[model samples]
Target: MNLVDQGAFRWHTLWLERANRSNYRKDGQILNKQAFVSLLTPPGRGAVATVVVGGQDCVACVAERFDAACGRRLDELVIDRIFFGRWRSREGPGEELVVCRRSDWVEIHGHGGRAAPASIIQDLVEDGCREMAWPDLLWQTSADPFAAEACIALTQARTQRTAAILMDQVRGALREQWEKVIRALESGDIPTASASMEELTQQSCIGLHLIQPYRVVLCGPPNVGKSTLINALLGYQRSIVYDQPGTTRDVLTTHTALEGWPIELSDTAGLRDQASGVEAEGVERSRQQREKADLVLLIYDASQSSPEVILTEGSGQQHLTIYNKMDQRSSGLDGEGIFTNALTGDGVGDLVKAIVETLVPLPPRAGQAVPFTHRQVKALKASQVQLFSDQPQTAAAILRAAARVGPVVSS
Candidate 1:
């Protein structure tokens, strides 16, 4: 039999068993089987968008709006099968899309844009499926907290490496590690559990940044190549470039991925004491950006005298000093700094590598257990504390609690 038949047979058997024990009708009708619809893909212009409709009677609801290209009705489509078709709306013809039927769900792959997905969702809603946000839908469908988090993070992943790591968690990498720790605790292996918790806790620092981009701010005295360098790094002219000082009077930000890690680069106004009004405001904002940035690039013109005071001021923060216009004669200054010519894109590649290394000292390996949320970190820390207190049972309890799934509701 086909996959659909197999799924139907299994579902029918389970339904019958439940019916025998409860209020399900003998006519094969399920009670209180509410259908829900959610947009599985990000809402924006893209190559494709996925809309998921699930629960009992969802197939019948989708069947009313879907017309298969092969002349097959939606209910006639087999589970685990893909059908190319046109999704119709109440007004007229809608966008052409691909629909996949599953045991308890239907996935609609449609053209990605504001109107197409919205139209499809409206059609589904009109057909009696309740609309739900993706995160809430994910939380409801996932088997565990780790799986739910993995599903949510997968959507925001900016690189294949990050996506692969989340996929590992979804496939039980972190869950397996949690089980190991629990088993170790049950067996009175405090040291083993403690060691595992410590390692995973340390890795959490990097894990938490997987879905969020690192903020890198460029700050320096006026007339330095900060704007030019930013343009070169982004491979586009996002910041206004001019030879005059104070050309960039406000913070200009752009996002990009460096070495498969997401990063947001900010070009700030040059820092100087002699400023007033708008220029002073920009300088103040620049300082604020430097204070909060994950990494600050303190730039100086290689041909000019170094500002030792600026470097000293930025020393307290995580920063890198870069000497621009290396094509010109080097200033007789002595200190550690990267030399580059933003005009020619010289040394930019080395600069990118340095940024990546500084931010992510040790990239996560595939299948590694890393905590991505504050709750997970707190749980790990609690387990560690219990592990050292001669409380194996308590530690085991904490470990299980850490792995427990919590309700995630959308705001």
Candidate 2:
């Protein structure tokens, strides 16, 4: 697939429907709002448009607008059977209007026009149909929004690893983890509980490792083959490699899979003590990127002897030192890291393996308790912090708060 053609071939239609309910409460508790979803996204210009509505009054509201093509009224229709119909506006006097209604819901199968669906939705809104955002609709009625989000994420996720991990999470990995922890707590097994918490934390971190790409920044002195190392790992010419010291004037990025983990690898300008002008700014930016990176690959050319390369203080423990040009005469340095000839693609796989090891240390169990959102993680951390603090009651309160974010039964 061409990156340039991404989303270009499709004639996109944007939905601007707002969540609406009778008596109008956005909190969703005042009235169980009917929810709608579209199966087909624009690009295929299919003749028919299908909108699915879900909620308490979905079937009844839809039945009112529908006249089944088979001479069946939606009010007397079966739950799963499709009724062919021309929906007319109830507010209007006659059958000049058309919309499709189903059991407890309505599907307006109209001509695929730029404005037809919008016009239909507007008609529904005018007739007191509540238009709601997909998220709000799901959250109000679904058992777990995180699980639903996970399902959606799996559908859109790019890689097989991502799809697999998200699918498992949605299937009850997090719930299982919570259940194990709660069970241990109920059994008065404090040691088991502590161990379970630690395991849960590790599982959560691993889940994050699965879904999000880890940022790995390359840093080293000028002319140490930092760009060369990046190209070697990526197996493509992603950056300009030059004999000159400051060839890479800005940070260049390329993404690749390291083992099963996704990685965002950055090749930044060489860090040096002094630079004339823009190169100096580039060097400062390189330092900042290094500090922010999840992993830093510090490169040093084996040919260079004067200024020994070492990681700066802010570089994380995930940092790996690359000794490039290892084919040259030995500089007598030895370590438990990669020694590579970036020019020839030798030992780059070993470097990638090291990165994968750092990113994902183990195969996470299918049903592990992993926080699916940053909010869940934050709440869990807050609970853990409270647990460690002197106030036991406060810690319980924090746990309750975290429990509120998910389901209390899981907590």
Candidate 3:
């Protein structure tokens, strides 16, 4: 579904504005005249839990079923007041958990567990609560459009680094970036417009990485210290380290962040002249990772052999060759490549810098005029249906079609 229609377009904007007025709050938009319910708590276990129920007349709907423990009527409860109460399962006569409600929109903060909160949710769902993901629910009731999108983006973040980046977006980082572009457009400054658009587009791309983690693999011969390098890069022991050849018979994948870019770092079994069955399978997986990686770090032992002895050609898109264990010998790389000792952390900063520079390009403008979503892509293509038409407005109509489905602020 389109991001706007999914309710992100409004929820985010209102949520942010409300947040500005008060630190603790949530906003939601109703979908199909039905109220949206979201479990603010994470999917798994936690100490405390938050459940947000919002929609038109959310206050009324929630007030009817929620009984305040302080002997206060739900209608008499002040806005933004935290009232302690036992959350009763709407499906039956049982306390769900100790709950609290907010003024503008109600927030139920209660004791957390797998059973209690889940039962509450199940009860609500059975009682006509449209059980939805937190992001989708917020999108439905959101008053601001961009904030809604930001919420979805933030919730989908795959890594802490990515989450940090998208958290910036949610706080109007992208909006400010787009405002600069809008200013340039208004001034009829073609050069500035083009430049700003280019810059913003780069930001948009980088911003997406925060939403979707990219795969990065370290590929090379076995015993080349690939695992050692991985341990060094990760700043902790992650992979098995043994001098025995072929010890790593399978690809070891780990999630790590570099310069706010989340990467799925993989250490594959070494590629060598002879291989056991397991090593062969690891080698095959290495090849697959190399093919899929956004960037590949090819490690070669400088003291042993050149990269040519291991991998013949460089990747077409993006890759780097590293000469590791430089402390053993200062002979330097026999061929052109980056040199580093994953053992002593020598040149590790450079390795990280190279990775960041290669992967995290700047983001695009907010509401990119061009199609970024599948729906917009399809709509733009359909506009071409009139390319061969006789109507004089065909080209203009097509352009309009592209624009309509393109970025536009919600009312």
Candidate 4:
């Protein structure tokens, strides 16, 4: 695939999408809500537009506007089956459509133009159905906001392993754990709550990455085989590899999985004492990115004397020193570092293992509670602060709100 074609996500590497559902604060509640209509697709040009309506009267409302091509009324249609139809608008001519009927909601699929979907939504609103934004629609449809977020995260998940970890959250691991925290608080067990909070905060390193791959930036002086190493790890030619110094003028990124863990790897412009123009800018950007990266691989030429480890303060980034081009060593060397030949793919597999193990030391297991969003991690930390401050009640309230289980009575 061309790098320029995937311009936006290519360099960014499918970064995190913040799924903060703090305001809703609901879980395991009855799904009954006022009948609402929403256009799931954007009101712009597309192939097919989807409008979902849910409530006791949702099917009746949709049936009024639909003329099924199979001569079957929605009442006779099988649930989850997409029936062909025509959406006859009271104001204008009808449009071709295919709609699926579900247990609680009925989806109307029609022309993805501005006029057709807008007309249909307006008609539904006129018929006493509430008009809702797509996000609001999802919030209302889901029973638990935390699990709902997990579902959303699962949609963007890159690998089956990550998806499995996230699926646990969707299956009530997140909500159940928060429920435990709230229970401990209600029962005045501050110690237990604090310990759980600390553990979950640590899990944020893995939980927050359920959808986004970890940011792994490879950096070193000019012509140290950073590009070749990244290519070896990715098993493909993602970065342009050249033997000349400063060949990579910008940070080139690609996403790949190692040991079922998704990682976004970057090959950056070589750091050098003498640089000019775009090379200088690239070097500056690489330095800035290293500070923000979860893991930074400091690549060095294995044939030369081992370079001094660069010490960066307060960046909180884990640094792994990599001795590259082991196949071309002038002499044998001894050191505590990952040795590899990016050109021949030697020791690259061990390097990949180390990268994953460093980033995620303890992988989430089945039935484990992993707070998989910023909102969750923040709430956990905030509540821990409250507990530490001797305000058990406040901590309980915060956990309850974050869990979306509403307020619990403190015992």
Q: In terms of lDDT, which candidate is strongest?
A: 1
lDDT on C-alpha atoms for all candidate structures:
0.77, 0.62, 0.61, 0.75
User: TM-score of model 3 relative to the true fold?
Assistant: 0.73
Clashes of each: 0, 12, 31, 0
User: Against the true structure, candidate 4 has what lDDT?
Assistant: 0.75
Scored against the true structure, residue 218 in model 3 reaches a CA lDDT of 87
List the candidates' TM-scores in order: 0.77, 0.78, 0.73, 0.80
Q: Can you write out model 4's per-residue Cα lDDT over 1-411, one digit (the tens) per residue?
A: 222222212211111111212222244322345567766654456667777776657788888888898988887899978998888777654888898887667878787768878888998888888888654545545547776677666656777787778778867888888888888888998778778777788888788887778899999988889999999998888898878998998888888887888888888888886889989999988888887788999998888865645556788778898999888764655666899999889999899889989988998777788888888777787887778888888888887776653332232
Arrange candidates by lDDT, descending.
1, 4, 2, 3
Candidate 1 per-residue lDDT over residues 1-411, each given as its tens digit: 333333223333332233324332323323226777877555555677777777678788889888999998988878789999988788887878999987667888888767888888888888788898866654444446676676567666777777777778767788888889999999987778778887788788777888888899999998889999999899989999999989999999999989888899999999889978899999999988888888999898888765534644654667888988888835576657898899999999989999999998887787888777777777777777766777778878876866755522111
Residues 1-411, candidate 2, lDDT per residue (tens digit)?
222122211211111121222222334443344444433333234455445454557666566666677677676766545555565664553332344443334445565545656555665566566776444443444444455556544534556766677767666676566555555555555566567666767766766655577889998888988898888888889899999999988888888876667789999988877776999888888888888788888888776554465658745457887888878735655544577899888888888888888767776765555665665566556655644554334434544445432443212
Regarding TM-score, does 1 or 4 come out ahead? Answer: 4
lDDT of 3 by residue, 83-116 (tens): 7666555454566444444544566666665776
RMSD to native for every prediction?
7.5, 6.3, 7.1, 6.9
User: Which regions of candidate 4 are displaced past 4 Å?
Assistant: 1-35, 39-50, 68-85, 90-104, 109-134, 306-314, 405-411
